[model samples]
Target: MSETNRQWLLAKRPDGRPTEDCFEMVEREVPDPGPREVLVRTRYMSVDPYMRGRMRDAESYAEPWDVGEAMRAGVVGEVVESNSPRWEAGDVVNGNLRWADYAVADEDQLVPVDPDRAPISTALGVLGMPGRTAYFGLLDVGRPKPGDTVVVSGAAGAVGSVVGQIAKHAGCRVVGIAGADEKVHWLTGELGFDEAINYRETESVRGALAEACPDGIDVYYDNVGGPITDAAFAHLAVRARVVVCGQISLYNAEERPTGPRKLGELITKRARVEGVLVRDYVERYEEANERLAHWVADGVVQYRETVTEGLENAPDAFLGLFDGVNIGKQVVQVSDPEN
Candidate 1:
């Protein structure tokens, strides 16, 4: 490892959608590990829709990224030096390694990654935050039961895709909503979703929901909120559960977009709507990971990644999320280990 490393920093706050100019790449010396810390060489970096929120200076569940500081993200890397007895050189670990090539991680922050069950990268996608988001958000919050009708928006995305599959595995009749026809086909034909709707081409989301879910929607796992949420809310059955996982549609909006006026329906239907943060279930991550891994191993769950080849293309890769350019989890391969 070199004494200095190249890293990207948040140059300026983005007014609307983030552009390449907002990120500035610079070279900095590798930071030394303090007591109970480990130095990691990042191999893969995640570029997700949630990061768009952090770019704004406004208050959010998490702090905004500071100007001139390295951008943050969930990352997987190898420990090259360790100051703690809990880890040693050659150990692969995952944590909030941010968007840099090298990071110093605290002993309590990093988790070991095993390559035997699946690729180590799974720790960032299917077996990691996104997977846990789908599992707990749908099962725990949504409380889906056998024969329930479950509808998931952004069904082709990393989290929503898994949510729909897990719902099917739970014996629910699953319906997925995505942007393109191809994604709709993948969700319904290959992923075993009972039905899929391409929201972009569809004239009425509400009509589509009514058509797909003739029995009424028992659970709605919402990933891309906006008019789509309004449509799903309009069809909630009695005692229905709505899981608010994300609102990607409003992420790049200059102002909050108006949604359907359907609060009265909630009362009429005696339905429940709740927002979820996957971090709340950190204590049960091991259990979630085990089950998710089992599902993947048994061919009950499948995943995809729209990977960008070089570190320099990270900005473009990240921007693609807003334009529906990514088909699944968007990741940037900084450097191939075999290279």
Candidate 2:
């Protein structure tokens, strides 16, 4: 085993869109595990839009990342040393761990990952947080009924892609809004969405949605807020459920956004809008994991990954999220197991 570990720290807070300048890397001796703790070598680290919000000093759903301190992310790793009865060397686990090649966690803070069930990398992607987020956010909050029209913004992303697929499984007519032409093809052609709109090519998203959703959108799964959300609000069906799973379009703004108030439109349409956090459904993660695993194995759901190699490039991979540079889950590959 290597004698040292390299970790990324928040060098400074971002005033707008984050840059690689905000991160600092440092080397430290790989510490041994304390009682009930395990030392892990990270294999994959996830870069999510929500992490951008954490860079701010202000409090939000997740705690803010303190400048100069080690930042944590969802990581899949192989245990190299252990001080707990439940774990041993060579066991693979997943958890919210340090953005480094090595980290130490209490055994309970990690979940055993079965490589035989699926690739270990999936514990940080499709079979992990994003998939579970889509499962509960759509089924519990969106509440789509069969034959309802379900439209998902940021539809080609990890969470959004899963949201559209789950909505289709519920027998809803699925329409996806994505930034690129290829993403539109994947959503409509491969994932089985009823229709897809390439937002960048269209002159007016609202006009495109109006033509596609002739009966009005019944379940609007919002991932990117802004003009697309504004357009979606304009086409809500009566009693439509709007599930706000993410707002990637607004995550980096330095100032609070002021846009047209669509509340009046919602009032007349009797639409319901609610925000979701995957952490709130922790008690039900097992259920989501089982079902999503089944769906993946059965070919009922599919996922894609955009991976950046090397831990040194974590910031670059993270910055890519805001640019819509990734078609599905964006993760950083830190190291291989047994390294």
Candidate 3:
């Protein structure tokens, strides 16, 4: 066992957009596993939009990361030491291991990963939280019916990409809104989206929606809420469903977002807007993972990941999410397990 392990700690709460000052790298002793616990050597760590909320001290669906604590994140790792009967050395697993080289996981937290099924890193992305989020949020909340027109914001992102693909698989016309033309091309050309609009180049998102969705939007899977969400709301047809999976546009906002000025339209259209937290559907994780894995295997679903090397670059990779720097899931390769 190594005498020391390195980790990134939250140095201070960011006033707005986080900078390098918000994080501090530290080295500490690697603790031994206790009864029913395992020591995991992290391989890959995920950087997500929801983590921005965890950086703030304000009330949210989840607790904020405490200052001076190891910054928490979803990680895929190999068990180097285990005291739990359910796990053994060399087994790959995924859990909330934080931003560290190694972490101790209790029996209740760790989930074993099968490398033969899919890349173990998928446990942090397409086949994990983001996939389940899209499944439950779209199917259970958005409820897209066959022949309906479904739209997704942040369409190139992990959750939003799956949402659009799943809607298309459900026999609906899926429209995607992404940040760049390349992403838009991938969404429509490769992912089978009915249409894709690059919000960055398009002058008016509302006009784009109106042009693309002549029948009107029946289901809206919103990942990057703000003016784009407002635009989608304006284009909603009667009895439309809106699933609010995340608000990346609002995550970095120092104050509350003021974009959706058309709430009255919701009442006029009798549309329903529901906010979703992936944790709410934890009971169905295995089922969702199984379905997602099958979809991946069948080539019914495709995904991409923007991976950055080294643990030291994690802060940069995290900040990249706010700027649309990632094409799909943003991941950081901390250390090669074989090394």
Report the lDDT tens digits of candidate 3 across residue range 1-339. Answer: 568999999999999888989999999999788999999999999998888888899898878989998898999999999999999999999999879999999977988889999988888889988889999999999998999999999999999899999999999999999999899999998899989999999999999999999989999998888889888988999999999888888887898856468789999899998999888888888889999999999999999999999998999999988889898788999988667
Using TM-score, rank the candidates from best to worst: 2, 3, 1
**TM-score winner:** 2
**Candidate number with greatest lDDT:** 2
Worst lDDT 10-window in candidate 3: 251-260
lDDT of 1: 0.90
Per-residue C-alpha lDDT of model 2 across residues 1-339, encoded as one tens digit per residue? 888999999999997998778999999999889999999999999999999888999979999989998999999999999999999999989999999999999999999999998888888778999999999999999999999999999999999999999999999999999999999999998899999999999999999999999999999999999889999999999999999988988898888678657888789899999999999999999999999999999989999999999999999999998889998899999997645
Q: Which is the winner by TM-score between candidate 2 and candidate 3?
A: 2
Model 1: how far residue 174 lies from native, Å: 0.4
- Number of clashing residue pairs, candidate 2: 0
Q: How do the residues 177-245 of candidate 1 rate in per-residue lDDT, one tens digit apiece?
A: 999998998898878999999999999999999999988999999998888998998899999999999
Q: What is candidate 2's CA lDDT for residue 253?
A: 84
Steric collisions counted per model: 0, 0, 0
Please say which candidate is ahead in lDDT: 1 or 2.
2
Give the C-alpha miss distance for residue 279 in model 2, angstroms. 1.1
Error of 3 at 157 (Å): 0.2
Q: Candidate 1 — which pairs collide?
A: none
Better of 1 and 3 by TM-score: 3
